[model samples]
Target: MSQVLSVNVGAGADKPYAKVRLTGIDKRPADGPVAVRAPGPKRGVSGVAGDFIGDERHHGGDRQAVYAFQREDLDRWQGELGRDLPNGCFGENLTTVGIDLEQVLVGERWTVGDPADGEALELEVTDPRIPCRTFSGFLAERGWVKRFTADARPGTYLSVVRPGQVRAGDEVRRTFVPDHDVTIGLLFRATTTQRELLPRLLVARDYLDAETRSLVERRETFTLDDA
Candidate 1:
C-alpha cells in the first residue's frame, strides 16, 4: 500500500556547507501529525507547519509548498553513494513508499490519510525539484548537481490543495490525474537536459508551477520572436 514512511520538518539552522550559511534541509521525522496548508503569497513560506525553507528567492511558496521523495529512490542513492540515507535526508517533507514518484503526472492529486477523520491532506503534484548548490553541498558529492540532473529522478514538489494534518503511516490515494503526458520525470528532463522538450510542456501548462510556467512562457516568446 502507498503510505507515508515519515513526515519530516526542519527548523532553520546554520550550515557551513550551505551557500546561504543558514538552511532547513536537514529535516527530521515528526513524532506526530503535522499540519499542511497552502502557504499564501509568500515566497519562502512552507506549507507544512514547523517546516522551514532556506532560500526565499528560489524555494517554497504555494507551488513548491511541500516536497516528497520516494524511499525506493533514496535506497538507490544509498546504494550508489555507499552510505545510509534515512528518511528526510534529501530535505523532503514527506518520505513516501510504494509510489512511483517519477511517473506521477504533473497535476496529479493525492489524498493522504483518512478523510473521514477530517484531517486528510490533499496535495497536487506541481513540479520536479531542480538540484541546487545546497543539495550538492548537503550530499558532499563531487559533481552532485550534474549527477542528480543526469539521473533525472529529482523528486516532486507538491502544492497543498486541501488543508489538513498528515502523519507517518498514512495511506496515500491518488484522487486525480491530469489528462496530460507531463510526468515529473518528463518535466524534469524538459527543464534541464532537453530544451527541445520545452515546447511539449505546453500541453500541461495549467498544471505547471509558477517558475516552470514562466520558463515555458519565455520559451514560447523566444520561439515566436525568433520566427
Candidate 2:
C-alpha cells in the first residue's frame, strides 16, 4: 500500500537540466505530492510512444526513469552529507513514501493517481540505475553512485504500463507483481557476472528488449568454452 509522497519532474524549474549540467543538479525525489503523466505531444522523447521523462537519444539505457525509496536511506545519507548540501541530493523523479527501496524489484507494479481524476497509472519497475559521473559530482564523493549501484538496491526504473496523469499529492499504491516470473534483474545478471544464470533467464525472453535481446542471442551463439 505504498503511496506516491511526491512526483517530481526535472532538475529544477530555474535550472532545467541539459545533457552536461544535468549531472550537477541534485535531483532528489520530492517528499511532498506531485502530478505525473506520459509527456504529451510536445513532451514526447523525439516523438514516440512509451518515451517519457528520459533522454530520447538513448532509448534502452538509463533514461525514462522513476524512483522508489525508503526514508531510512535519506536519513542515513543526511547524517553523512546533508551538513554541506541539500538532503536527498540524488535528484530522483518520484520520492515514494513508505516504499522500501530494497523491496521494489523489477516487475513490480505501482498504481498512482487521484481517485477523483479517474486516471490511475501503472508503472512497471525496470532496472536499477547505474551510477555515473553526474552522481559522483553531486555527492562530491568519488564513487557514491557506484556504492549505490553495486548493491542494486537503488530505487527502480519504471516503464509506463498504463499511461495517465499523476499530480502532486496524488496517491500511489504499489503491488508486487510476483517475482516468480523472469525480470530485469535476471537480464542484468545475465549481462554481467552471473553468466551461469543466462540460460535460465532466456526462458523469460518476452521481457527482453531489442538491445538486450540481441546481446544475449549473440552471446549464446558463441562457443565460450574455447574462447
Candidate 3:
C-alpha cells in the first residue's frame, strides 16, 4: 500500500559542505506526528513544524512546502553509491513507498493519513526537486549534480493545500490527478537536459511553482526573440 514510510525533519546546523555554512539537509526521522501547513510568503520557512530550511533564496515557501522521496528510488541510489542511505537522507520531509513519484502529474493531489480522523494532510505536487550544490556536497559524490540530472528521478516537491498532521505509516491516497501530461520527470527534463520540451510544460502552467513558471516564460520569450 502507498504510505509514508517515515516523516523526517532537520534542525539547522553548521556544515562545511553546505554553500551557506548552515544547512538543514541532514534530516532525521521524527518520532511522532508532525504538523504540516503552508509556509509564509517569505523564503526559507518550512511547512513542517520544527523543520528547518537553510537557503532562503532557493528553498521553502508555499510552493515548496514539503518534499518527498520514494524508498524505491533511495534503494536504487544506495545500490549505485554502495552506501546506506536512510530515510530523509535526501532532505525529504516524507520518505514514501509504493508510489511512482517521477510519474506523478504536476498537479496531482494526495490525501495523506486518514481523512476520517479529520486530520489528513492535503498536498499538491508542484514540481521536481532539482539537484543543487548543497545536495551534491551532502552526498560528497563526484559529478553528483550531473549524475542526478541525467538519471531524471528528481523526486517531488509539494505544496500544502490543507493544513493537518502526518506521521510515519500513514496511508497516502491520490485524491486528484491533473489532465495534463506534465509529470515530474517531464518537468525535470524540460528544465534541465531537454530544453526542447519546455514548450510542452505550458500545458500544466497552473500547477507549476513560481520558479518553474518564470523559467517557462523566459524560455518562451527567448524563442520568440530568436524567431
Candidate 4:
C-alpha cells in the first residue's frame, strides 16, 4: 500500500552533479531491477568488480557522498539548508517525501526502481549515520547534533542490490524486517541511558556500527569481569 507523495528534482537538473529529490510514500509490494556493483572493500578495489552483497564506506577512509535527510525534517529541509548555508549546504542526493523516515528501523528492506522489472532489486538498512562536525558546521546549526541523535532518526543506510538511475519521484517501497526484532530506539537507549539493558539491544546487532559494537563490547566486558 505504498504511495508516491511528491517528486522533486534539482533546479539544475542538467548539471553534471544534479541532485535528485523524491518526497512521497514508498510503494508497497513493489519490486524493481537492481544492478549492484562492488564499489570496493573499505578503501579502493583493485580487482574483480560486479554486484556485491555488502560494501563498507569508512574502512579505508574513502569518502563517498550521497543524499541524506531525516523524514520529519523534510518540510523545510531545503529552505533550512539554503537559509543556513545561503549557497546550499547538505549534499543529500535525494530527499524522501511522505515517509516518516524515523520510523524505519534497521534491517528494513527496500525495493527500488521501475515496477516493470518485477522486484528488480533489494536494499537493506544497515546502520545509523552519526553526522560529523563538518556536516553540522556546514549547516551552522549548534544543536543539530543533539537534535539528530535525540531523534534517533538516523536515516537508513542502503546495501544496494540493483544499481540504476534513481530520479526524483521514483517510488521507494519499504518492508519492515528486524533481524533481532528490536527497534533503533531501544538500541540507542541501551547504549546511552539504559546501559543495563544492553542485552536487549543485541537483538539488532546486525544493524549496529563499529562504534556501537565497541561500546557494547566494553559494557559486556565490564559486566563479565568487575575488578
Candidate 5:
C-alpha cells in the first residue's frame, strides 16, 4: 500500500541568487496535517496556499501545483551521498512510499484518502520536474542539476483536482490511469536531452501540459519543414 510519508511546506524569503540563504527548496516536513488548496489563477495558480514558490516564471501553476517524490529514492540517494535526506529536502510537498512515480502516465489521477475529501485533494500526475539552478545551489553540490537529470529519477509534478488538507501517512491509491505512453520519466527524457522522443509526445497531446504540448507542436512543425 502506498502512503504519504511526509507533508512539507515552506514560506517565501529573500535569497541571494548567487548564495543559498533559506530558499523554499529547503522545505521541512509539516508538524501536522497541512491545508492544501489550489491557488487558482487568481492566486498565482501554482503552489498550494501555504507553500512559497521562489520562481514565478518557472515554478507553480495548474500543471505544476504540487511536487511529489518517492521516499525510497531519497533513501538510496542518502546512502550514495552519505548524508541525511529529510522529507522535503528537494522541495516536494508529499514524500511517498510504495509508489512508482517514474512510470506514471500523464493525466493519471491519485486519491490520497477518503474518496470524498480526496476527490478534492485529488492529484493528477502531470510532468516530470526539471531541476533548476536554485536546486543546484541549494544542495551546494557541483553539477547537481546535471547529475540529477542524468539519473532520470526526477520526481513527478501534479495538478490539484480537489483542494483539501493533506497529512503524512494518508492512504494513496491510483484513482485513474490514462491510456498513454507519456510516462514521467519518458516525458522528462523527451523534453530534456532526448530529441528523438519529442515527436512521440504528440501521442498524449490532450493530456500533456501546455508547455510540453507546445514543444511537440513546434518540433513536429520543424520536422515537416525540413522534410
Candidate 6:
C-alpha cells in the first residue's frame, strides 16, 4: 500500500544553511518521470542526475544512492514545527506514503512502479541517514540534529537494485523484508549517540551498511571468550 508521493532532485551548489554551509540539500519535485539508477559504490555520488553535491566525502555512493522520507512523518513534523513541509524539502529523493520507517529493516527491498509498464525501478533499504549540521541549518532548526535523533525517524537511505524509471504516484510495494529486528529507528540509534547499540547491529550482519558493520566489528576489543 506504500506509494511514492513525489520524486525530487536538486541542482547541487554551495549554499548556506543557518551558520553552517553546505550544498545539494535544496531539492524540488521532478518535472516528470526521472530515471532511477544505482549511483554505484565505486565512489558514491548524487542519486539523481543533474543534482550536484559539494560533500563527496559523505553524501553519495552506491550504499546511499537514494534517500527517502515518509510523507506521513513529514506531516507530523509540519504540525509540530508549525510549518508547511513540501515534498523534497528534507532532501529526500523519494517522498513516500504508508511505509513505516520505525519498522523498516535494513536490506529490505521495494519495487517502485509497475513492471507491466516497464517501470520496475527497484531500491534496497541500506541505512538510516544521519542528520548533519547542514540538515540543521537547512531547517533553521535549533538543536535540530538532537531533535531529529531523539525522534528516531531519520528517514532511510537506499541503493538502486534494478535501475529504471520512477515517477510521482508510482506504487511502492515491499518486495522483501530482512528477518532482523534492525529497524531503521534501531539502526539510527545504534549509529548515532547510542553507541551502546552498536553491538546489536551485528545481528543484521548481512544487512548492516559497511560503515555501521565496521563500527560494530571494529569496536569489539574483547574476544568472544571475554564476553
Which 10-residue span in candidate 5 carries the lowest summed lDDT?
40-49
TM-score for each model: 0.94, 0.67, 0.95, 0.60, 0.91, 0.91
lDDT of model 1 at residue 183?
Answer: 92
- Candidate 1 lDDT over residue span 20-72, tens digit each: 76799999999989999999868789999999887998889888899999999
Order of the predicted models by lDDT, top scorer first = 3, 1, 6, 5, 2, 4
TM-score: the better of candidates 3 and 5: 3
In the range 101-145, model 3's lDDT, one tens digit per residue, is: 999999899999996866678999987898999999999999999
Q: Which candidate leads the pack in TM-score?
A: 3
Per-residue alpha-carbon lDDT of model 6 for 17-48, expressed as tens digits? 62224487888898788887877775538666
Could you tell me how far off, in angstroms, the CA of residue 84 lies in candidate 6 after the best superposition?
A: 1.3
lDDT per residue for candidate 5 within 1-227, as digits (tens), equals: 89999988877766665233435676888877677766664423445557877666667777788899999899998998889989999879899999888888888898887666624468899889998888887777888889999989899988888777678889888989877778999899999979779998898898886667899999999999999
**Cα-based lDDT at residue 40, candidate 6:** 71
Error of 2 at 7 (Å): 2.1
Off by over 4 Å in 6: 18-22, 42-44, 117-119, 219-226
Q: Which pairs of residues collide in model 5? A: 45-61, 46-61, 120-162, 120-163, 121-162
On a 0 to 100 scale, what is the lDDT of residue 179 in model 4? 53
Each candidate structure's count of clashing pairs? 0, 13, 0, 15, 5, 4
Please tell me which model should have the higher lDDT, number 2 or number 3. 3
Q: Write the per-residue lDDT of candidate 4 for residues 1-227, one digit (tens) a residue.
A: 33223222222112221111221111111123213332433542211112111123331111222223443464455465555321113333334656555566656766655667764444555544555544454356777767656756555444545444443356777755665655545655566556788766566665676677777778778877985
Q: How does residue 147 of candidate 3 score in lDDT? A: 97
Best by lDDT: 3
Error of 3 at 107 (Å): 1.2
User: What RMSD does each model have against the real structure?
Assistant: 1.7, 5.3, 1.5, 8.7, 2.3, 2.2
Question: Mind sharing the TM-score for model 1?
Answer: 0.94
